[model samples]
Target: MPSTSDQTLENQNDEELNSLHGKIKALRSVTIDILDDSNRQNDQLDRTGNTFTQFTNSLFSTSRHHSRSMAASSTVRQYRTIAYIVGAVVLLWLVLKLWSFGGTRSVPPDGVNGEYRI
Candidate 1:
């Protein structure tokens, strides 16, 4: 039979081993969780990168289209500018004509026959 002290020592060793095992299991669970979180973050980053790329491509295409349209319509743009200037001139002329037509009238003096009233 084992001595009483030896039994006590064995029990203590068993308890310590169980505690160490529990700690190891906890560490393994935490490591797995970390790996899962990292994978999710990587997937999200990839999706974001792809979305940004698509948006950039769309923006570039729109800018190119706008540039082409502007280049092609330069004559139209010039005509529009001239029309704006002519419209402004016509509006100014109309305003001046109306103002002159509505000129102020001279009022007669306040008198009975030819002598002014006191």
Candidate 2:
């Protein structure tokens, strides 16, 4: 049988120990929650990284496609311009040839009296 004061002191010590244990359990629970949150964040980061990579690849692919098309369009425009210039030059040359061929001829100094010449 202990004295009343000793029993009171023992009860106080038990209460303090129980409180410490409860706090420890709560702290451990919080730690586990933090770890779970970090893991979830890590998973989200991985997904975001993959998405960014895919987006970058898609942009590059689109850029390449656009660049190729633009290059082809530029080439086509150049060819069309050259064709137009060549066509115009050919048309001018043909006109000049026809003009020279159709020029007036001078009369012959001696005229023939044969039927074909007349």
Q: Considering every candidate listed, which one attains the maximal TM-score?
A: 1
Off by over 4 Å in 1: 75-118
Clashes of each: 0, 0
Candidate 2, 21-118: lDDT as tens digits: 99999999999999999999999999999999999999999989867876778787868867999999999999999999788454544455623321
Q: Per-residue alpha-carbon lDDT of model 1 for 15-95, expressed as tens digits?
A: 999999999999999999999999999999999999999999999999898678767888889688679999999999999
Q: Which 10 consecutive positions of candidate 2 have the poorest summed lDDT?
A: 109-118
Question: Considering only N, C-alpha and C atoms within 3 Å, which residue pairs clash in candidate 2?
Answer: none
Q: Quantify all predictions' global Cα lDDT against the true fold.
A: 0.90, 0.88
True lDDT of residue 36, candidate 1? 100
